[model samples]
Target: MPVVSRFLGIIIAMYWDDHAPPHFHAKYAEYEITVNIRTGVVEGKFPKRALRHVLEWYEIHREELIENWELCQNDESPKSIEPLE
Candidate 1:
């Protein structure tokens, strides 16, 4: 997995040729969640406050996330996204 962004001690990443539904990974401490790129659905667990930040960042960067998803699908390096304030 290549990290695309980091904020509030949370690391966001995506895998090349990963599983479907166009998603990205958000990890905070020991908790990790895979969030759907389009729908914001999440799998796994994360702290509530951290999850909020992750979703906010997702909303702010959905388009870029999709673009990165494309780049990842092609096995190309992903561009870094701006972190949440």
Candidate 2:
């Protein structure tokens, strides 16, 4: 997994050649969630407040997320995105 962003102890990553729906993984401590880039829907477990942070970050970087998704689909390394401050 390539870490694309990190802030507030939340680690956001995306795997090379991952599955569909253009999502990224957000991991915090023992909690991890997969967030769909286009819809902002999350799968798996994460704190509500943390999830909110993730969603806010995602909203700000949706275009970059999609670009990274394309890069991953092509087996290319993804670029780092700015984290929520």
Best by TM-score: 1
Q: Candidate 1: lDDT over CA atoms? A: 0.96
Residue ranges of candidate 2 with Cα displaced over 4 Å? none
Candidate 1, superposed: residue stretches over 4 Å from native: none
Scored by Cα lDDT, where does model 2 land? 0.94
**Which residue pairs clash within candidate 2?**
none
Candidates in order, TM-scores: namely 0.97, 0.96
lDDT of each residue in 1-85, candidate 1, tens digit only:
7999999999999999898999999999999999999999999999899999999999999999999999999999999999999
Enumerate clash totals for all models, in the order shown.
0, 0
lDDT of each: 0.96, 0.94
